[model samples]
Target: MSEQNQDKHQQRQQKVKQKVDERIAAAQKEQGIFQVITGNGKGKSTSGFGTVARAVGHGMKAAVCQFIKGTWECGERNLLEKAGVEFVIMNTGFTWETQNKESDTVAAQVTWQEAKRMLKDESINLVMLDEITYMITYGYIDLDDVLEAVSSRPAMQSVIITGRGAHRKLTDLADTVSEVRNVKHAFDAGIKAQKGFDY
Candidate 1:
């Protein structure tokens, strides 16, 4: 009975390997990818930072623009800036903290101007637009303007956009889209955000 089970497992493995090999062989093209990470889960921004780390490992230049999060020091911002990544932290804090619509709109516009420059720069290999979805969702910035700038960027420059409630158009334009579903969270259980783990 054991011998029979082993033979069946080997056969299944061989079939799976063949299918995987075929897919690998078919995928021969490479180009800059637009990636979107969004959802209620905690890892949206973290996932974007992972790509920044990947770009750094490859010695590729990267630019990161933080839209609605500033005011306080962020671990990724400090590390990436120290590692020579072009980093911009734009607001005084989240929207709720600022409590000013007009001012927040202005800040969003200014931050996007810098982001647009980074996107267009051919020398930059990757650009991470952190928490940009909120700006779009709240009508702080024009979606068309953002789309125009992004679509006109260098052909080989990758872009990673992370936040909750991503724009539908942005998701459609992205080559890769991932939604981090929340099954459980430490914050929900009354645990505070931990250093180096939550940040």
Candidate 2:
């Protein structure tokens, strides 16, 4: 490249670096962040689990409350359980499949009790509520209870909520919200949910 072009490139990069430095310097607070991963696409729970794994990798205490799950084995749970991450499963599977609102409500409430305990426990560094939005949607769990527990959680405890069509209140309270759009999915093409990949 010509010296003039190279000089211009250097100047542009220098300005970019300055902006980045300023932004970095401006962010000085250290506190746990609430993250919401929701949308019509897959991978919401996967993303939440990934964050739990990241916390475990850093030797942080983490707990996961899996709503609307059955007895099926989870790959992430298998690994994280061994890593000392506490797990509370609703064990009700899909609400449509269960077709028993009374029993499902009971199960949801029981699982939510465990989640509330984890949220109040200051020792736990992170809590992942997997597919919890469905419970709220079905009225199986109280939305106010969830909001209160999360909002009152330990200041250093981070929470991750993942599901489709998350409540507006949750999105508003979250520090980071990510929406996964469904452009295409293998299930629509008659592809079965593979073990490790889907679970």
Q: Which one wins on TM-score?
A: 2
Name the top lDDT candidate.
2
What TM-score should be assigned to candidate 2?
0.95
Q: Mind giving the per-residue lDDT tens digits that candidate 1 earns over 10-54?
A: 999999999999999998888888999999998999899989998
Work out the TM-score per prediction: 0.94, 0.95
Cα lDDT computed for each candidate against the true fold: 0.90, 0.93
Residue 106, model 1, lDDT: 92
lDDT (tens digit, per residue) of candidate 2 on 1-199? 9999999999999999999999999999888899999999989989998999999999999999999765778999999999999999988788888899999999999998999999999999999999999999989888888899999999989999999989999999999999999999999999999999999
Steric collisions counted per model: 0, 0
Give the Å error, residue 59, model 2. Answer: 1.0
